[model samples]
Target: MSKLIFVNLPVADLPRSIAFYEGVGATKNPQFSDDTAACMVVSETIHVMLLTHAKYRQFTAKAIADARTTSEVLICVSEDSRESVDARVSAAVSAGGTADPTPTQDFGFMYGRSYEDPDGHIWEVMWMDMAAANEAMACEGAGQAA
Candidate 1:
């Protein structure tokens, strides 16, 4: 069986978080959700477990760092093309998430942008052209790529 990945994030409002996730294309999985927690399916293999601040306290004794005030994690997802990357970021912004201030990356073979959810968790959407990357590698000298 294929392995599944679950990213757990602490959210101030569970329902709001679920709505934000849904806006960005994730479907809520009621099977693994409850009043204090939500299971958001990002893809077939990726799921996000959104836990309320109080619910999160059960998993750790350390203080939860506010994602808005402090960097905790940058969750990245791959898209099929550059347009797809931009679309996701746009959807996120329209759903009340803030776009990352950093400029969008535009390498010849790769493109990426990021957005922060209402709870301040960053989500990066990236797309890589493998064929272009392979071609670039073929044309480049060893030192340049390194």
Candidate 2:
């Protein structure tokens, strides 16, 4: 069976967080959702659990790091193309997120941009050219490229 991933994040407000994620094209999984938490389906295998701070603490003994004050994690998603990355970031900005000033582009191999949500959660939108990466790997294997 394929492995499943559930990323649980603490949110100050569950409803607001759900609305923000919905704006970014994510659908809520009502089957696993409730007043304390909402399951956001990012993809078939990826699910984000936006749990209220009070409820989220019940799952872990460690204190929840305030995302607004510290960098606890950076969520990154791969896009099909660079334009898609840009579009996603733009949508994020329009939905009350802040886009990073500069985007990282490493030739034709990889490109990425970042946005921070209202609560300071970072989301990176990236595009990776697997064909270019494979070609570069081949050249490096031949001892000609870095």
Candidate 3:
């Protein structure tokens, strides 16, 4: 069987977080959702559990760091193209996220941008052309150019 991943994150408001995720094109999995948490389906094998701060604390003894002041984690997702990256970042902004001031660009090999959600969680959207990367690596191997 294929492995599945569940990314659990703390949210100040469950309903607001659900709305924000919905605005950015994620669907809720009712079968795994309840009053304290909502399950957002990112893909067939990936699920994001948006848990209330109070409930989330029960899972860990360490104090929860305020995401606004300190980053707890950075969730990165890959897209098909740079345009798709920009579109997703734009969608995030429209859904109450703030884009990072600078975006990372590595000359056709890879590109990425970051956004801060209302609760201050950081998310990075990126695109990498493996074909281009392989070709560049081949050139490097021959000691010619990128």
Which candidate leads the pack in lDDT?
1
lDDT of 1 by residue, 29-74 (tens): 9999999999999999999999999999999999999988898888
* Top candidate when judged by TM-score against the true structure: 1
| Runs with alpha carbons beyond 4 Å of true place in candidate 3 | 144-146
How big is the positional error of residue 20 in model 1, measured in Å on the Cα after superposition?
A: 0.3
At residue 89, candidate 2 shows an lDDT of: 86
What is the model-wide C-alpha lDDT for candidate 1? 0.92
What do the candidate models score in CA lDDT, each in turn? 0.92, 0.85, 0.86
Residue 123: error of model 3 in Å? 0.9
> Which digits, one per residue and each the tens of the lDDT, describe model 2 over residues 23-142?
787899999999999999988888989999998989999998877778898888899999988888888888787888345655779889888777778888889889988998898898
- List the candidate 1 regions with Cα displacement exceeding 4 Å: 141-146
Pick the winner on lDDT between candidates 1 and 3: 1
Q: Estimate TM-scores for all models.
A: 0.93, 0.89, 0.90
